[model samples]
Target: MSGLRRKLLIITVLLAAVMELIDTTIVNVALSHMSGNLGATLEDTTWVITSYAIANVIIIPLTSFLTTKLGRRNYYIGSIILFVVCSFMCGSSTTIWTLVFFRFLQGLGGGALLSVSQAVIFELFPKEKQGVASAIFGIGVFIGPTIGPTMGGIITENYSWPLIFYINIPIGIMAATSCYFLLTEPVIKTKVQNVDWTGIALLAIGIGSLQTVLERGQTEDWFATGYITLLTVTAIIALTAFILWELHIEHPVVNLRVFKSKTLSVAAILTFITGIGMFTSIFLTPVIAQRLLGFTPTQTGLLLLPGAIIAILGLMVSGKLLQRGVSPLIIITAGFFCFIFFNWNMFRMDLDTSAYTITLNLIFRALGMAFLTVPLTMLAISSLAPKDIPQGASLNNMMRQLGGSFGISIVNTYSARRVASHRVDLISHITNNNPLTIDRINSYTAYFMLKGIAWDNARLKAMGMIDAAVVKQSTLLSYTDAYFMIGILFAVTLPLLLFVVGGPKITAPKVIVSDH
Candidate 1:
């Protein structure tokens, strides 16, 4: 393929990938609008997000099998068409359930956009330049979710909620039309005569149920909810059975044997850990800005923009360093420390902190992730046999997605518990016998009295104000605690870097071929 066509194909795939990823978080800020417009409760509207996530987790690991069975070009183009159709349906739906159903369908297609697109990008470049490919793809991966909230906020605030879903249509159509003409089928195809029906069933049930549990667990109070308990048991059983069945068969759907490569295994684990930090920070920062700092959705999104741009520079610089023979292990180690520093700085944030301070801390986060994303991609599949690369890539991507889910769940539950604990401890010090507490209440009462309230009523309002203050302060403390937990998690995982040996000579990806 010529340079121009290669660049066009890369841009086409990256656009599609970014569109899919952006959809994952774009609906978040619009949940209230969706709830009001659809005549549903806030919780019901959230299924729009949860349903899509469940579909993504289930379908991601199956892409390698689907691509082989359907052919790469056919599968890629088909998925894009499906995604576009679903986006239109999602936007046009008048009912909540209808929208959720189509969002789930969109996710099924979105999974291939990520896994297959990564494979295609890798195939576009030569063996020695795979790091550049990873860097290029990393831009889409990192920036897609980073800017999603910003775009969603802008669209939702200025227009309507449907615009978020509608926006995907034009981009998806463009990518599909481009790929249909430029993308080619793999010349050497592996035909599957006997489909792994059992593996597919178990995988869907296991991953789908697990993802749902993670998405809804904190909202439903974890295992205390009956369905959460049932789903947890079902997930454990189904996943264990799926692993055993896959390993026992001659041709498995997911190819569990790929884990035998030590480098791939270590890389997968590290990716999982990285996903925890990468996603949890994105999840936490916006909430802190909007809930405590009095920032609007657009302001919060704008706070992240500078860091997102800096992240692009970080990605390119790290990619060049890799091309110039800087060890991935060294790059990855540096990424960990950068991330640790980001967490530490964020942990020091208080209610009085300014947006500029938070933005600076987030820039460190962007740099850490930029350094990590490309190097990790290069490391994961570098040692794999060319034939196993797709399966390896699929598994690696799935791990990252799962890690994000787990991280969000853990932090959500932890923050809630800490808030309750902190609130209780704070309230205990507000007894009548405490002079400072009495004086604080008196000052509040005087402030209310100055507004012309009677003494008795002013005292009551003062006590209510104290309660509100306790809850607010507790929440703030919990957020800082959450940041510290994220930092400590990274600090503890640093030793895993020691286990990463250098990957072997890299081979070009075998999954894609250009029809020039």
Candidate 2:
């Protein structure tokens, strides 16, 4: 490919990847509007998000095999078409379930966009420039989700909720068209082998069940619900069996053998931790801003923008350093410490915290992640043969996704339990005879009386208001506690960096062909 054509291809592939990722979080802020418009209860409306997640998790691990089977260029084009068509259908649906189904199809299509885009981008460049390729792809991976909610909020506010999905149609069409013309299929070919059907079934069952339990568990009050219990058991059994089967199977759907590579193993572990911190911080910050601090969706999204910019800078700087022979271990360690500092700062957040404070802390977090993410991608693929790079990348990506799911689930569960515990502690201080309690109640009563409430009614109203205030305070404290918990997790993981096997420093190779 010519220089201009290669650049255009890279731009096209990056756009497609970003489009896929943005869809993952874009619908989040618009869920309420969707529920109301579709005439579905909030709980049922949640399936719209859950369906996409389930499809994404399932399809992600299967991408390597699917690409081999379908041919990369054909598969890439097909996925874009599928995504665009589904987006249109998702927008036009008259009922909630129809939209959910379309979203699932969209997820199936979007799942390949990330993995294939990475592979295509890698193939575009030569061996030595792999670090630069990774840095470029890193932007889409990290920035896409951060930007999703912000862009979604802007679209929903200015237009309508359906426009969020509708907006993808034009972009998807252009990407698909460009991909068909620009993406060249590799000449190398492989024989068709029987796919491990059993492995696929078990994987889908295990991951799908596990994701369902995680996403729905909090809303259903965890183990208190019968369905959650059953799904939990099913997930455990399916996953255990899948692991065993993959170990023994002649041809597994996912190549579990890649984990045997020491570099890949260490990278996977670190990637999982990275996912935990990245996803949890993003997930928790929005809730803190919108729910606790009373920021609008647009305001909350804008607050995160600076961090994303810092992260891009971090990626570029780290990429250049790696190209010059910086040790992966050192860069990763620096990242871990930066991440810990960021979270530690977040632990001090209050209801009145300023946007600049949050933005600054997040920029540190982004820098930390930039140092970590690119080198780890290099570490994971460095030891593998060219044929195995895609498989390794797919597995690494899948683990990160699982880590995010695990982090979200654990954080939500812990936050809920903490709130209850704090609420109990707070309520204990509300003894009827306590002077402070009496004074607080009297002040509330006076406010109610001024609003024309009767004496007995005002007292009851004041007590209820006090109870609500106490609950809010307890929840706020619990959120802060969660931030501290994340900090500790990052701090503890720092020692493990010693074990990662850093490859010998070499100059990055030049680009011979454009994979994009």
Candidate 3:
């Protein structure tokens, strides 16, 4: 390929991958709008997210098999087509369940965009230039979540929520057309002799059940609910059985055998842990903006723009350094430390934190992510044979996404419980017997009375104000605890980078095994 065509192909796949990842977090700010428009309760509306996530995790590990069946270029184009159609259908949905159903299908299509795009981009460059490929791809990887909320917030506030989905149609079409004409399929030497329907069934059931439990665990009250318990048990048993079956089967839905490659195995672990911090930061920031800082959705989105801009340079720098043959572990180690330091700084902030303060911290977060994105991705599949690259990419993407799901669930549960605990502790200091507490309530009552309120009404308002304060303090404390935990998480995972081994440079000649 000429330089112009290669650049265009890279740009095309980058957009495709970014679009898919943005959907992973875009609707977060629009949830309230969706609930009001669709006439669904907030709890039921959450399924819109859960359904899509469940579908995404279920289809991700199966991408290699699907690519084998359809051919790489065809599968890529087909996925884009499915995504575009489903995006339109999602916009047209009038009911909550209808939107949820369409979103699930959209996820099935969108899931392919992440892993397949990485593989395609790497293929565009030779082995030595793969770092540049990773650099270009990593920019989109971090930018997606950053821009997602910004775009979603802008769309939801100025227009209706449906515009969020409608916006993808044109981009998807262009990407699909360009890829069909530009990308080539790799030749495969061996084919799966038999299809493992049993393994596929077990994987679907297991992963689906696990995702549901993660998304709904807190709302369903975890093991306190029979259904939650049932899903949890089903996930455990099904996953175990699937693992054992895949180990012995002639053809597996996921290529678990790749785990035998130390490079791929450690890369998967690091990627999984990175996902927790990466997604959770995106999740928590918007909530903080709306709930604590009282920023509008658009304002919150704007606050993230600077970080996204800075991360681009960070990605390019890291990629260039790696291309010069710098150790992958060195870059990863630096990223882990930067992320931990940033998280700890966030833990120390008060409610009075300025937008600049938040944005500055986020810029560092993005930089940290840029460092991890390219190296971790390259480490996972760059070592594999051309035939195994697709499978490695698919598995790596699955682990990262699954890690995000697990991270969000855990932080959600921990924050909820911590808020309750903090509120209790705070209430203990608010008793009537305490002179300061009594004086504070009396002062609030006097302020209300100055507004011509009756004594009873003023006292009631005073109590309400105290309750609100308690809730606010508890919320801030919970956020603090969550950030602290994330810092510790990064620190604990840093040791794994020591054991990472990069695959040797590719020297084998190419073989064509495409169905085409």
Candidate 4:
């Protein structure tokens, strides 16, 4: 490939990957708009998010096999077309279920974009420059989700929510066109092996059940609900069967054997933790700002922009250091500390905190993520044979997604329990015997009575108001407790860095091959 052609291919892949990732978080701000427009309850409308996530997790680990089965170039172009068409359908839908269906289809197409893009980027670079390749790829992975809500807020505010999905049409078409003209299938041919129908079935059952349970567990009140209980059992049975089937199969869909590599094992574990920390923090910060501190969607999005910029700078610096022979372990250590610092700062957040305080803390968070992401990317694929890179990347990526699901579920459950606990504690302090409590209630009742409310009603309203105040305080305390929990998660993981082996010390490989 000529320099110009290579650059174009690289650009195409990166843009496609960014488009997919951006869509993942973009709809977050538009949920309320969607609810009103479609006349669906907030609970039902949440399926819009859950459906897409379920589709994404199911399709991600299947990419490596799917790519080889369909030609790489063909698969890439097809996925883009699927995404574009689904984007149009998603925008044109009149009903909520229609939109959810289209979003799920879009996710099926979008899932491959990230994993395939990572493989292509890695393939484009020589082995010794894998670290640099990871850095380049890291920028898209990190920035896309960060910028997604911002873009969605701008579009939804300036225009409408449908435009958010519609916007992907033109970009997707262009990317597909570029892939057709510029991207090439590897010359090395893979054997036309039997399709692992059983494996695919197991994967779909396992991952789909798992995602549904996680996404709906809180809404359904966990295992107390029959549906949640059923899904949980299904997930366990399907996932266990999937593992056993994959390990025994001649041509496994996901190639579970890749875990045999010690480096890959450690990298996958770390990637899981990184996913938990990254997604959990992202999930919490915006809710904290909007629900507690009263930030607009745009304001919340902009608050994290500075952190994204800092993260980009960290990526560039880390890339340079890796090129100059800095050990991966040291960089990872620095990244771990950066993550811990950000989480620790989050613990200090309160209702009255300023935007600048959160922004500065997020900068450290972004910097920490930049450090872990690139090096872990290197660590995951570094020891694998060239042909196994896709499988390895798929597995790692899937684990990361699962980690995010797990983290979100765990945090939600913890916050709910903590809120109840704190509420009880706070209510105990509001007894009639307490002088301050009595005075506060009396003052509120007097104000209500003066506003033309009957005395009896005013006293009842005052008590209700106090109850609400207690709930709000408890909620804030629960958020703080969750932040501390995340901080401890990162802090504990920092020491595990000593165990990860560094990548090989060598110059760039002269030739690269991709097995299609």
**Better candidate by lDDT, 1 or 3:** 1
RMSD in Å for model 2: 2.6
Residue 161 lDDT (model 3): 93
Query: What TM-score do all the candidates reach, one by one?
Result: 0.93, 0.93, 0.93, 0.93
lDDT of each: 0.85, 0.83, 0.83, 0.83
Give the distance in Å from residue 214's predicted Cα in candidate 1 to where it truly belongs.
3.0
lDDT of residue 394 for candidate 3: 89
lDDT of 3 by residue, 435-495 (tens): 9889999999999999999999999999999999899889988987898898899899887
Give lDDT tens digits, candidate 2, residues 253-362. Answer: 88889888888888888888998898778777877877778777777777778888888878777777776777778788899999899988888877778988998998
- List ranges where model 1 is wrong by over 4 Å: 32-46, 93-97, 219-221, 505-516
Tens-place lDDT per residue, model 1, 1-516, is 677788899899999989988887777667767888999986678678677777877888899999999899999999999999999999999999999999999999999999999988877776666766777788888999888878887887788888898888889989999999899975446777689999999999998788778767877988899999999999999999999999999989999999998888988999999988987888788778877887777887788789899998888778777666677778889899999999999889889999999999999999999888887887788888777888898899888877876776678778888999999999999899999989999999999999999999999999999998898889988988998998999899998877774565322222223333
Clashing residue pairs in candidate 3 are 187-512, 187-513, 188-513
- 303 in model 1: Cα distance from truth in Å? 1.2
Which digits, one per residue and each the tens of the lDDT, describe model 4 over residues 1-516?
877788888889999999998887778777777889999986567677667767777888899889999988998899999999999999999999999999999989998898999999888877656766787788888888778777877787778999999999999999999999998886455664899989889888888887778767776888999988998899899889989999997888889999998888888988989988877777777767766787877787788789888888888777777777678888888988888888888887777889999999989989988888888887888889998898899888877776766776678778888999999999989987999999989999999999999999999999999998898889888988998898898788777776674445422221122221
